[model samples]
Target: MFYTLVKIIHLLCACVVIGYLIYDVFIFSHFKKNRSEVEFIKLKRELLKPSALILGLAFLLLLCSGAYLASFYLGGELGWLESSFQQILVLKISVVGLLFVFTPISFFYILVLKKSDPMRKFYHHLALLICLIALIFAKLMFLF
Candidate 1:
């Protein structure tokens, strides 16, 4: 029961982050770039702050649940480190860690750097790629 609950929570959190990343990467960021001053200001006032807060919370939940899930298989007979799945899992975690780091940096850039800055796109696309990779790793983990 506890494992199932945690797995569900973990999957939900991953879904939240992945959905938001895809939207931000392919849609929101581009829309933000092209929006007029009034539209951009409206976005900053209404959406940006709330989205950041949600993303931060989602990332936290994902991190904690993911860590808990990983802990179950890391030692004893499961020995995740010895399995073929270990490398991809580790890579996914590392990418998630990078996402965690980049989240704040992207926010800081949004706050400080001009909207015209292309760097945020770089970060967004990188995050999108990692999210896709993590999803694939997740599937492989279930199968193998």
Candidate 2:
């Protein structure tokens, strides 16, 4: 029961993170082209605060719950270093770690600095790619 609850939390948080990234990369980005720069900037400023808050919270929850979930697979006869599942999990965690770094940089570049660089878009795409890879590793964890 406890494991199931934690798993559910982890799943929900993953959905939140992926959903936010999709919105950020696909939908919100395209709005810039339709609106005037000033209007877009204003809209971005208004939306970024709440979006950032929710995303940050979801990430924190996801990380905590993921660590808990990973603990279950670590305590078998095979040492974590020797287990294929653990190896894949380590790779997933490493990829997810990149998002921890990327998220702050993306937020700072947009919210604090208030500069819209083309490179920022690249970072978003990269993050989305990273998340997809992590999701793939998640599935591979059970298969291996």
Candidate 3:
């Protein structure tokens, strides 16, 4: 029952996070470059906080539940690690680990760096790319 609940939450959060990540990468970033100031501010005001919160919760739930599921169901199985499924799972986990590292640095950069800093945009785009890749790899893990 506990596992089932965690799995549900994990899946739900993953959906929300992945959807937001796709929008961030393909929609929001493009708007950042091309949209008018008033339009961009409106979009940013409407989405920035909600997206961040959802993505943050998704990451948290994904990490906790995924680790629990792995440790609970596959802890003693060496062959699982040797399987193609496990190889994809390992890659997914690696992407998530990279996200864990990149997220904090991105947050710090946002908090500390001036908006005028040229690297801010680069960092923001890179972080979004990481999140997108992580989401894609995570889905791939379930297929194999």
Candidate 4:
């Protein structure tokens, strides 16, 4: 029962995180390119706060539930270090860790750095790309 609950939360959070990431990469990028400062600021005020809050909550839920699932289902008894599943899991975790680093940098760029700064755009796009890759690896890990 406990495991089932954790699994549900993990999957739900993953969906939320992935959905937001896709929007950030696709829709938000386009908006950033075409929108004026006032438009962008308005959109950011309307969208970013809620999105960021949801994303943060989703990430936290994912971390907690994922840790529980990993330790409960895949660690110790599974001899995870010796298994392909474990390798894939490790890769997924590493990518997530990279996102942990990239996410804050991207957020700060958006919240603090002026929009005209070229590096802000670069870091945002880079973070999205990394997130997309991480999402792909997560799916692949499940299949493996």
Candidate 5:
């Protein structure tokens, strides 16, 4: 029961981060050019803090819960790390680790750099790609 609950929380956290990354990369970018500079700047300023909070918190929770769940699979008589499924989990965790590094850099660009810079969009797409890779590994972990 406790494991099930943690799995649910982990899944929910993944959904939150993935959904937000999708929104940031696809929907937000599409809408960005439609607005005038002044309006867009105002909107960006308003949305930045809250979006950061949501994404950061969700990603943190996801990593924490993932670590908790992964503990069930590590270092046993059968040697969990030697299995293909656990290997895929390690890959997923590694990819997520890259996201952990990139996220702060992206946030720094968005917050400290000029709002109109193109790097923000680049970072968003990069994050989306990373998340997709992790998602793929997740499926593979279950399959094999």
Candidate 6:
């Protein structure tokens, strides 16, 4: 019962994170046409009243719940260097780490790139791509 509850919370948190990511990528992708960076940012703020706090909270939820789930495989996780499943999990965790690094740079970039700037778009696309890969790896974990 506890595992089931944790698993459900983990899945729900994942959905929140992924849904917000998809929406941000889709909506802002179009701002490149006529919007200045300031205008784009203003529009984004106006549209999404909720601060990034909610996203961060959801991420925290995922982390805590995921950690709880992983604890069930304490031995395997300890020998992650040897087990195939652990190896994959380690990679997923690494990618998620990178996602954290990319997020701050993307959102609060020093230069604040224009919408047309490929690097800005690159960051968003890369994050989603990595998230998708991690999701697949997580599903594969159940097989192992």
lDDT per residue, candidate 4, 10-38, as tens digits? 98998887777677668886887899988
Q: Could you tell me which 10 consecutive residues in candidate 5 have the lowest summed lDDT?
A: 114-123
Measured by TM-score, how close is model 3 to the native structure?
0.65
Q: For model 2, name the residue pairs that clash.
A: none
Collision count of model 1: 0
- Report the Cα lDDT for residue 75, model 5: 66
Which stretches in model 3 have alpha-carbon errors above 4 Å?
33-42, 77-80, 103-119, 122-144
The better candidate by lDDT, 2 or 4, is 2
**TM-score for each of the candidates:** 0.74, 0.80, 0.65, 0.74, 0.80, 0.74
Tens digit per residue, CA lDDT, model 1, 32-136: 789997896687567557778878798788889999988876767877578777766876787667767776776776778745445654876888787888888
RMSD in Å for all candidates: 4.0, 3.8, 3.9, 4.0, 3.6, 4.3
For model 4, how big is the CA root-mean-square deviation?
A: 4.0
Predictions in order: lDDT: 0.77, 0.85, 0.70, 0.74, 0.81, 0.78
In candidate 6, position 96 carries an lDDT of 77
Model 4 segments beyond 4 Å from truth?
73-77, 103-119
**Per-residue alpha-carbon lDDT of candidate 3 for residues 1-31, written as tens digits (9 for 90 to 100):** 9888988988887777667656766787688
Q: What ranking of all candidate models by lDDT puts the best one first?
A: 2, 5, 6, 1, 4, 3
Off by over 4 Å in 2: 75-78, 103-118
Name the better of 4 and 6 by lDDT.
Answer: 6
Backbone-clash count (model 2): 0
Model 6 misplaced stretches (Cα beyond 4 Å): 31-34, 76-78, 81-83, 103-121
Q: Which regions of candidate 5 deviate over 4 angstroms? A: 48-51, 76-80, 103-118
Clashing pairs in 5: none
